[model samples]
Target: MKDTFKHKGLRQQLVNILITKGIRDEKVLNAIGKVPRHLFMDSSFLDHAYQDKAFPIAADQTISQPFTVAFQTELLQVNKTDKVLEIGTGSGYQTAVLCELGVHVYSIERQQELFRKTSNFLPKLGYRAKKLIFGDGYKGLKDEAPFDGIIVTAGAPFVPKPLLSQLKIGGRLVIPVGDAVQVMTLFIRKGAKEFEQHEFGEFRFVPLLEDKN
Candidate 1:
């Protein structure tokens, strides 16, 4: 239940594993090392927390694998002053990572259970996002649109147009798009109606639900 010395050491090992797997961003590595992933899950799953793999949390959603979190964040290329919107807040692990980078984060969670639990749990750890909205991520945050970066933590069936539309010019939207399996996709908004797209290989994730709350 506490972030002890052993936990911190384990996290450092996880960071080392991530570095070998190609996560080069120092800030991202430090964030991954700093966040106590064990505290994010039930005590029963404590042993699995820093294993660089995803583990189930409440509401059937899994805390993303550490490598995946580092990969998506590295793609965003955001600075401390940037505003990042995170879709699928999940266990708030990713949110905590963004907070470690000192960026303003606005995260959305569709599951009512996760929304309430994470809303309370995250602040207790001192990782307060700009806002944690219990709403549809497919729609993004219109009022808080024009974000410097938007990240979808779940496997969206397809790239939602609104997520792209909400990005500021040159902003990055990192999403995993697929059905049974997902290919990590990145969209960089170059202009009003232009976006550059790139796809990484496959990864698995819980489906990104819509209007489920």
Candidate 2:
């Protein structure tokens, strides 16, 4: 529960590394710097928390690498008060980042274990999603439709149609699409029935699963 000065120093170093790696969004970098990533992982991997790497969490999910989180977040172009739907709430680290940027976040997790753990953990860290539900990410929270941005933290075989339909016009959806190797993809809703797609390079993520207990 402690965020020591040492941790703060390490996070600053990480922010510098991100800068060198081409993450120019200062808001995103500041969010990365402020979040105590060590709190998001098992204590066994605490030493690696400040590194720009991903490590295993419970329920066969991996916390996304810091650069990957920043990249997806940057693509969203999140503005303060924007309503964002996060498809996977694996570690709650990415959710905290969005919260830091002052966005209203509704995140869904398919794994009940993770959903419960994160929902309980985040508020303790003073980072809370507006809503965190145990449900299918593919469904995109239909009742909470028209998000200003949608971010899928796991790799999707294809873009979920519900997610696209749930976007407000001019909203962005950032996701990684593929089975084994994913291409970081972005979709901007330009108009009703109109979207603009862009592809960044490849990344590997745990698959975004469907139904779960």
Best by TM-score: 2
TM-score against truth, every candidate: 0.98, 0.99
Q: Positional deviation of 155 in candidate 1, in angstroms? A: 0.6
- Residues 1-213, candidate 2, lDDT per residue (tens digit)? 889999999999999999999999999999999999999999999999999999999999999999999999999999999999999999999999999999999999999899999999999999978999999999999998899999999999999999999999999999999999999999999999999999999999999999844
Candidates' C-alpha lDDT: 0.94, 0.96
Candidate 1 lDDT, 62-123, residue by residue in tens: 99999999999999998997999999999999999999999999999999999999999999
True lDDT of residue 109, candidate 1: 95
lDDT of 1: 0.94
RMSD of each: 0.9, 0.8
Clashing pairs in 2: none
Clash pairs, candidate 1, are: none
Best by lDDT: 2
